[model samples]
Target: MKVDGEVTTGLGKAAYFLSQEFYTKEFEKNLGFIPYPGTLNVIVSDEYLDEINEIKCNCENLIKPDEGFGAVRYIEAKLNDVIVGAIVFPAKTTHDENYLEFIAECKLRDELDLKDGDIVSLEF
Candidate 1:
């Protein structure tokens, strides 16, 4: 399955959660690399909300959070048809259904030379 979304700025909060040792360790173990200490925020088109939810539902690699933190679920995907990454959904996110969070071994924005309003596609 594939989903496309527009690049958008995030709330500047993902780094806090991603940088935690708990999450970084799990990411390294489950994802085979320690993700960069942040996420690439993308806003999906409304028409694809169902597909996004389906992807969320199919996630099996769940990361249970530490005390006072929310769990995250993710599925492996390819970004821009090349880079391996994971699309993540955090239970405590401020985003609605239209948003998808991507985590990769490196900063995706820099890796892809992306900026706000750029369109990116993810394939699973």
Candidate 2:
């Protein structure tokens, strides 16, 4: 289906295929492993500044991993004057680096049209 100028061929159909064939190969060649699924908080708003602030607030409230292997970072994607998506990274820490998962959840309390907010708890 076409929405605006973008196409949605069903939930994750495009991203899944792209990730498997293109993203995975490219990422592995450039980076390393197939990107693991990580969580992110998506927030959309007209006020970009406020949206950024909200992302910061959410990250501050995020629960840190007990193993000291991961942390949460917020990323905001904007489309023109409107905020599109807010991403939260639950990342793994290496000796001198960090790797974030590829799944995203919500952190905002307001009624925003975004994905659900599910707290991620993992051992590895």
Candidate 3:
């Protein structure tokens, strides 16, 4: 399964959640890699709305956040054909339905050399 989205600027605030000791430990334990201290935001395409929604609805028990944190679920996804997939979910975010967030083993910005306004492909 896969979804599509473009790189978008976030509020520069994922570190708040990603850096928490509780979440980081779980992320490393479940997601098979130590996530970087932040996430990459993407504005998903409209065509995949139902798919993303399905993921949200049925993705519980996979890697949900512990108590005191916002809800989350994860699936592996590849970025730009790299043999990597990010764990994606929503938090106490202001993003709309089109927006998705990602966490991975390495810094996505550095791995892909991406910049704002880049057209990137995220696949699972």
**TM-score winner among the candidates?**
1
Choose 2 or 3, whichever is better by lDDT.
3
Per-model TM values vs. the true structure = 0.95, 0.26, 0.86
lDDT of 3 by residue, 33-70 (tens): 77888888888778888977887777753545668778
Ranking by TM-score: 1, 3, 2
- lDDT by residue for model 1 (1-124), tens: 8888899999999999999998999989988999998999989889988877877888788999889999999888898999998989998988878988999999988888999999999887
lDDT scores of the candidates, listed in order = 0.90, 0.31, 0.75
Reference-based lDDT, residue 105, model 1: 94
Tens digits of per-residue lDDT for model 2 on 1-124?
Answer: 0011111112332233223444345434433344433222222223343534454456643324335234445343322223233333434322111212223122222222333443322111
On the 0 to 100 scale, the lDDT of residue 16 in model 3 is: 82
**Measured by TM-score, how close is model 2 to the native structure?**
0.26
Model 2 spans with C-alpha error above 4 angstroms: 1-10, 37-41, 49-115, 118-124
